[model samples]
Target chain A: MSAMNKQILLKSRPNGEPTAANFDLVETPVPTPGAGQFLVKVIYMSLDPYMRGRMGAEKSYAATADLGAPMVGGGVGVVEESNNDQFKVGDYVMCGTGWQSYCLSDGTGVMKLDPKQAPISTGVGVLGMPGLTAYYGLLEIGKPKAGETVVVAAASGAVGSVVGQIAKIKGCRAVGIAGSPDKCAFVVEELGFDVCLNYKDADFPEQLAKACPDGIDVYFENVGGKVFEAVLPLFNDDARMPLCGLISQYNMTELPKGTNMLPALMRAMLTHRILIQGFIISYHFNHLPAFLKDVSGWIKSGQLKYREDIVEGIENAPEAFMGLLKGKNFGKLLVRVADDPTRN
Target chain B: MSAMNKQILLKSRPNGEPTAANFDLVETPVPTPGAGQFLVKVIYMSLDPYMRGRMGAEKSYAATADLGAPMVGGGVGVVEESNNDQFKVGDYVMCGTGWQSYCLSDGTGVMKLDPKQAPISTGVGVLGMPGLTAYYGLLEIGKPKAGETVVVAAASGAVGSVVGQIAKIKGCRAVGIAGSPDKCAFVVEELGFDVCLNYKDADFPEQLAKACPDGIDVYFENVGGKVFEAVLPLFNDDARMPLCGLISQYNMTELPKGTNMLPALMRAMLTHRILIQGFIISYHFNHLPAFLKDVSGWIKSGQLKYREDIVEGIENAPEAFMGLLKGKNFGKLLVRVADDPTRN
Candidate 1:
């Protein structure tokens, strides 16, 4: 076991797009396992858009990660030492231990991972927070019935990919909105979505309308900007929207300029009796067991699939994460912080 | 009875503010009741801002009144003749009988009025749709627990008045928003609202913030536009919004100019886990019996109060209705189409 650990800390709040200067990498002593605590050597770190919200001082669903603190994130790790009865040395687990080589946990939020069933890295992606987010948001709020059209933005990414696939499994037509043709193809051809539209296309709205002939019954709102504008007119009566995230406007310093269509939005809601709800997965933590059960079964039966874009080194994590904001990553973005002992 | 009858018909679709030229008064032979049908002499016609939506060709909850068709509206009337076993002559009932001196009904959607309990005009105002709207909207969607702050726009109008009173009954601090100082005064002094702020006040937002120190938990959205803009910033985490109507923007021919704040609205909903639902009373008609029992008890116990603006004569119904859209009526606007036979 290494005596030294490399940690990334938040230096200052970013005004708009985050820079490498905003994060400080420092060598520190590896944390010791306390009573009922386990020391983990992180193998894979999840880089999600939600972390952007944590970086800002603005109020969000999750509390802002304080400056000068190790930037908070979800990661899969191998237990190096254990004082906890539930975990033992070399047991693979998923936990929010931030951007660090080693971390300490007391088995509170940490969950055991089965490398035999699926890749250990998936414990932070497909069978984890992003996957759970899509499952609950779509099933609980979106409530897409059979034959209904379900639309999701950022469709090639972690949450959106799962949302699209789940919609398909529920017997609904899944429409994906991605930034490029490659991402669109990945969503449609790889993830089994019925259709995928490039949001950057000049005729994106027209394409969306054509794709959703029955109109959109459920809109899994992950990216809110131009994609939202395109989806707005296609929303049918009694449309249900589960607002999971808004990656498009996360870096926005000022309110975007556009047609003030709030009245229209309100009218659509009132006339059509639409239900639009926003949620965070933490609020529905009690349903985690059920989520894992259903998701695991689907993955095992080949009814659901997931993709991962793994960056090899922790030093490249900030750049990969930044690229994720710009819709560059084609799948769930993760950093390989250390070699996987379970795989070896 | 005279064979001749006066009826108001849709003449033309208005551009913005409806004019008298948009409505036409026609003389027609009164139609006789058929088997299982009854004749009604409309005594009081309800004037509501929602009627504006019906005048346009645009799709809404209610179907648009076609040109040359008799203008549709809710009214309380005495059954002048009956072939239906359910109704008898001289029985006061509430029905959607259009703007006319007489109407023929096949007994569907007509409710018998208890003249001994309250004024017959209340069948078209506080104790009827508006009252039931406030009752169900607040209790079901708003779900204001004891001590929660509930804010309502158009506070002295039919629905808003009942909403504030109901919130007060539920041990909540009821804050009212009206257009005029006099209306605001009536809401606070007469209706017993904790605070009343005029929407016309230059410092209205500040006043609303000051009035709701704990923040608004339930916002009954009836009058949209600037009132909604003001309430947006003060909405607390997990706030419930029952969108009943958007009267302020009903007359809009063009989209309003401002920052597209829907992303912010979505972000707010996400950050707060707020539930915003739009509903119509017809959707929850089965709950009416329970609502009537609860609301009637509140009114009789002096815990609920209502106001009515009664305009005399059916000929003035058009002007009275026009005033409703302008927020000119101080209370529930009702046109006394005929003499209250029971009162006489």
Candidate 2:
């Protein structure tokens, strides 16, 4: 084990689009655990679009990341040292370890993980917040009935991939929208989505309309820009939209220059009786147990599939995170901060 | 009752805003009730925002109004002659009688009303569809908890008045927005809202924010142009919005010119985890019994109040309906097609 801990700190708020200069990587001597505290060696750190919202001083559903502090995020780690009675050394756990190699925990929200059941990295991926988010949002808000057409954006990403798989399991036609042709292929061939459209295509809206002949009943909204505009007109009466993220608009520092389409959207909503709900997964932790059981069962039965885009080292997190905003990562983007002992 | 049936029919779809040229008033000899049908002398006809959507060729939640048919609307009336077993002679009933002095009905979607319990005009106003809309949308979608701030637009209108009153009954701080000072006064003093703001005021947005100091927990959206713009920034975390009507945008022929604020609204929704849902009351008639019981009790106990803007004669129906879109009506806009026998 390394004697020194490497931490990525939020140096400044991003100006429009984020750059590597917004974060600072610093090293400090690893500290010993206090009386009831434990030290966790972070194996895999999550890089999500939501973290971008946290970088701004504006109040989000979750608290903003403080400048000069470790960038706020969740990670799966190993309890290397423990004085706490509940958590012990060698126990694998999931906690908000942020962008760091190691973090001290008193076990406020730490969940003990079993490496024998699945890959330890999945504790931060399919078996973690992203999977739970997709499960709750799709079932609770989207309410995709059997034979309904369920459309989800960011098709090959963490949450959307699970959303489409869950839709298929629930006996619905899952339509996916992705940035590239490769991701589109992955969503269809690998993830079992009924149809996957490349949103980058010039005739993407036309393709989307052709793909959804019955109209979209459930739209799992993650990317909200031109993508949302395309999905807007094709909504069936009583359409349900479970909105969790707007990756396309995250870097936008200004409102788009165009005729205000707010009224048009509102009119369509009324015409179709559409229901749009935004949610942050942190507020829904109570749903985690049910999600874990259902998702774990599905994963075990091969009804659900997940992919991890693993980037190596804490130093690469900034560039990878920036790339994530532009849809560069192919799947659940995770930074492998340290060697996974469970893998050996 | 009149010997001749006087009807106002839709002549043409409005280009931008509607005018008298859009409708035609025609007189025909009163037709006899056929087998299993009854003749109704229409007394009060409802002029609602939803009817505007029906006038357009573009599909709405409900079907578009036929070009030469009597303008589609609900009305309270008396059964003058009856061959139907269910509807007796001299019984007051509510049905889609449209803008006509007399009509023949086969008893579908008709609800009998008793003037002894309350005014029969309320069958199309406070005790009918408008009341039920407010009840279900507020309780089911808004889900106003005790001490929550509930803001409703078109405060003096049928649906909005009931929304504010129900919000108060649920122990919420009810804030209302209306078009004029008198309407605002009626909303606060007569309808018992905590505060009411005139949307026409230059500082109305500021006033709304000040009124909802704790932030709006539930916003009952009926007037969805400028009123919605004001309510957008003041939403609390996990705010609920039940969107039933968008009166301000109903007559819009083209998109408004400005920087598109859709992204800003989406961002706010995500930041606060807001839920915005649109509903058509027709789909929710199954909940009519519960809504009728609760709202009737509230009205009987004086906890809920309602006002009607009655324009006499079928000739004035087009003008009154035109005035409604401009917020010229003081309360629930109703056109009196025939004299009410119950009132006499």
Best by DockQ: 2
* Regions of model 2 farther than 4 Å from truth: none
| Per-model TM-score versus the true fold | 0.97, 0.98
lDDT of 2 by residue, A250-279 (tens): 888888887887998898888889999999
Share of real contacts kept by model 2? 0.84
- Model 1, residue A258: C-alpha shift (Å): 3.9
What's the distance in Å from true for residue A84, model 2? 0.5
Q: On residues B115-210, what C-alpha lDDT tens digit does candidate 2 reach at each position?
A: 999999999999999999999999999999999999999989989999999999999999999888898888888889999998899999999989
* Candidate 1 residue-wise lDDT, A127-216, digit = tens: 999999999999999988999999998898999999999999999999998989898888888889999999888998999999999999
TM-score of chain B of 2: 0.98
Q: Clash pairs of candidate 1? A: none
TM-score of 1: 0.97
The whole-model C-alpha lDDT of candidate 2 against the native structure comes to 0.92
TM-score of chain A of each: 0.97, 0.98
* Candidate 2, residue A243: how far the Cα is off, in Å: 0.7
